[model samples]
Target: MCGRVALASRDAVKACAGVDRELTSPTPLERDGEWARAGGRNASPGCAIAAVRIAAVEADDDGASARLARATVGDRRACAIEDVVWGVRFDSRRGGNFERSFNARVEGLLGGDESTFAAKLAKTVNGRCVVYVDGFYEWREEGPKGAKTRVKQPYMVRRADGKPLALASVLTPEKARSDAVDDFPRREAAVITMPSAGGELAWLHDRQPLFLWNDRDFDEWLFGDWARMARERRAKDVKGLLQWHPVTTKINHAAYDGEDASAPVKRAVEKDAGSVAALFAAATKKRKVDDETAVQID
Candidate 1:
């Protein structure tokens, strides 16, 4: 499951879509008094990730400078970049805080019997969304020989060409119901993940975001019938086009975010001399992350 993700910037998503007229969604999670600048480089849950979705656009806001933010494709339906929280929406019936479901498994949605949640998402035209990110982080647990408690190494995964990665996601019902951008609804979403292509990528994690290859795929995923796509397992196979490597552990901190936080670095591993006790001791030393950082990981 993806716990954290990174984006180059909002401009990257616009460039990737090559679309016109963007609606600047200001949904209030700002740290520097700027809304667009929030959840930037190293983004985690609760952060607003930019997502492209088809929405009804009125004639006035089509080119007007209200936000000059979201792009427009036509007079009726247009592709707009929406601010989507990286997790499921809250349900009051649950009473206390309910951990949001951020990742949706393909097995439940496509591979095996379709899940009721996925089924509803598939049928809801407004629920489909496209999220673009630069890369995502995954941790691999390793041990120094025979240590019981293994240390985890972080890795950043991205396209080989370093282009924006288009992820398939489902949005909350409130996102696109309004035709205007100023409605400013606080929306949430979950990324759909499929089993990883079994080679080098399997080493990092067992699942990966369902990817859209190009503009054609973007159209199909957002408009095409979900059952057909699911039956064919039509998600673009990205096995050869992706590259990943070890990254620094600074990302473990909730406060540590920026381009440098996700930068690639030499692998950090414990050098073991073969003793079980020595191996266990070496593994124990890497758990230097503080309590606050650990909370971010969860």
Candidate 2:
């Protein structure tokens, strides 16, 4: 059996627009319509690669000046397309004034119909999308513990270009809710794991609005709070709530696969709060990221 691979090209922006069509070519007429659609072209097990564009906008600086940052890739180019791996960490947090931390829904990008968690999590497709947020179901349960989970997955966003706009899926519930409308809507954040300041696990990707929360710290808090709530029968609230699911990165070079590409990229961008444009630019050249093994995902 041939395994699917990921690929990225120089003209990624233009190429990604037609990614769905290329991947959707017809199969053999005998196998079905795939062959007829492809004019008898055989399916290749080669990895697929696509591209996305992240626009840069000006933000208000602490000094009250307007600062504009360029996009990650040059105007002619878009962000790098990488393959999805098990090591890239992801989490979704729900934080707001009106609802419990755990008040949100988590849905699969690919259709959910498997007995195993791994199968369910691997459903992300070209146009796969999910809507996550908190919900409250009241029933005949005793104490603060409700009869059902705090949230439900309700809405999803459309995938524009191939480069999945924002990856890190975090839903912050609104402070107030009404019986007429939905509560927490999705707010996209680019989720990447970078090494810690001391050179641990801090990740980076495009320069976009970011939420900084250490993976280990956040996971520990989530599990602890969830356990406490379950035991005390007082599911008062889950603090520092987040939400997220794994997304398949574009199939790229073999370098990012397996144990060989496991090392984390050193900080091209500093951990402190500041403008990342200059930092991102400096690092790509200064650190010679292109030569690095895990530079591109696919």
Candidate 3:
């Protein structure tokens, strides 16, 4: 299960998510610690996480046409991002506690017979969104089931090409809770997952996040129909871009946010560190230049 995620900065996330600007973030990133400097190095469920989704702004025919015609960005150019809550309510049995789900299965979205909330949500543009993160944490259980000697080794999975991963997700149709998140009450969303394949990915978990790779992928995910798309597992194509390595188990505690917390404790993937290091350097430089640019896009 993917319990924790890490992100760079607001600007860096926007650049990677390819959005205009953050629409609403009621709670400021803390003034100090890793949450301030590096965003959340260890973000978990039931917290504020950045998500790019269709904004509440309704465009008329002209703006809608222009949005459809927008190249690369497509409809997402008009989309807005917010600090959305990270968990979705999957069940509400009488007298039972609500079940919060951090991950939703892609199979449910593809299922013709599924009447689950997540499956139904997959059919609407409003329900579609993406959570782009620096990386996420997964623990590999190494031993027999129920064995006392079993060890859980954690690994950080990020793009080998040094780009943030745009995880396919489905947002609940409406805000399911009355409680506020970051002072702005919001709907919940869960990252969609598919069967893991390609190299050692299955070693970590049988299910991996279904990530969108490029402009076309993002465009289709945000606007296209689910039933009309090919059913041969589209998410598998993005697996080659992923790489992972063991990190400090301190990440087990979601509040332990920092660069060092997510850093690889070992040199497992040859491309992992080199690409991530370069990406951080480039993100810093690009953001600096972007800050000074005279053209105001947003």
Candidate 4:
């Protein structure tokens, strides 16, 4: 299964470098150890990093395979889909950078137009979502699913409260992939900047933890809906630019602990280095029939 990590709070950036330091180093537990050793005051202990096991599940048929693969790519491609992630913005610019970054990774790996993927993704999932921008879990539901809105495909999504924002989806991955590009990258990378309910702040390299963010971006975003347009009409011009954390995850084997007899079981995430390494390995494993893990997008 695909796994991700996210940190909480605005000041979480302060702890990022330390996490990165352990990620790039030769040892695995060093990063987490360093953070723990630093104590709560030294680092923003509010950061929560959780790892999710995305089993390499196989589909039953062409439609199922297509759906599963598409959903995997689309969901994995878009960092916001993971359940462990939180604090994603729910405003109109919600999916902003996260969407584009996903498209870019797919395009770079699969060789297709990022816009095409974005457009398909726009159509695939709309409404039926809630976003947490402060690296915490929050929910809001609105919009239609599997149908086009008058404004455009992949429009900016807003939260019920009308403040935090993010790109949302009500459509299934199979539907989203029907219009998605085929050459989407098999490998991907992203970073989770926001904190999670677990209270840990750090960058992820592989199958370690689940934190939200890394799906918002400028190029792959669409905030030109009626609400935005109407707001633009009433006020001065506004520029919408999306940004994703440079933190990354990849698709490969060795990400999960396959060495044990029970290969499909979720692995432990005690050490940042070990878990992060596993995250990348899991990204590449082919979907098997057993790779089913449900995440509530709504």
Any residue pairs clashing in model 3, and if so which? Answer: none
Off-target runs (Cα >4 Å) in candidate 2 are: 1-80, 86-151, 159-298
- TM values, all candidates: 0.73, 0.17, 0.73, 0.19
C-alpha displacement of 65 in model 1, angstroms?
A: 28
Decreasing TM-score order of the candidates: 3, 1, 4, 2
lDDT of 4 by residue, 180-204 (tens): 2332211122222112222221111
Q: Summarize candidate 2's per-residue lDDT along 1-298 as a digit string, tens digits.
A: 0111122232442343222222112111222221111111111121111222121221223121112112221222222222211111223354622211211112221224454232232221111111111111111112224535332211111122223222222221112423211211111111221112221111211111111123322222121221222222211121223222221121123223333121222221222213466678788786786666455754
The top-ranked prediction according to TM-score is 3
Worst 10 residues of 3 by lDDT: 30-39
Worst 10 residues of 2 by lDDT: 130-139
Instruction: Write candidate 1's Cα lDDT for 1-298 as tens digits.
Output: 5578885566788788765556664455553421233445557776677888766522333234222223332222367777777787444566664577788776666655545465456545566788888888899876666877675778888889989899888876655433323434466778888776664577677787888777766766675555466455533456578888777777766557766777877665643334666767766765645555788999
lDDT, each prediction:
0.66, 0.22, 0.69, 0.23
Number of clashes found in candidate 3: 0
Measured with C-alpha atoms, the lDDT of residue 285 in candidate 4 is 60
Task: Give the residue spans of candidate 3 off by over 4 A.
Answer: 29-39, 56-75, 90-96, 143-148, 174-176, 198-200, 227-230, 234-236, 267-298
Considering summed lDDT, which 10 consecutive residues are worst modelled in model 1? 65-74
Q: Comparing candidate 1 with candidate 2, which one achieves the higher TM-score?
A: 1
lDDT, candidate 2, at 107: 24
- Expressed as tens digits, the lDDT of each residue in 79-176 for candidate 3 is 87776667786557867656778888877777775687677767666677887788888987654577666556678888898888888888865564
Clashes of each: 11, 43, 0, 75
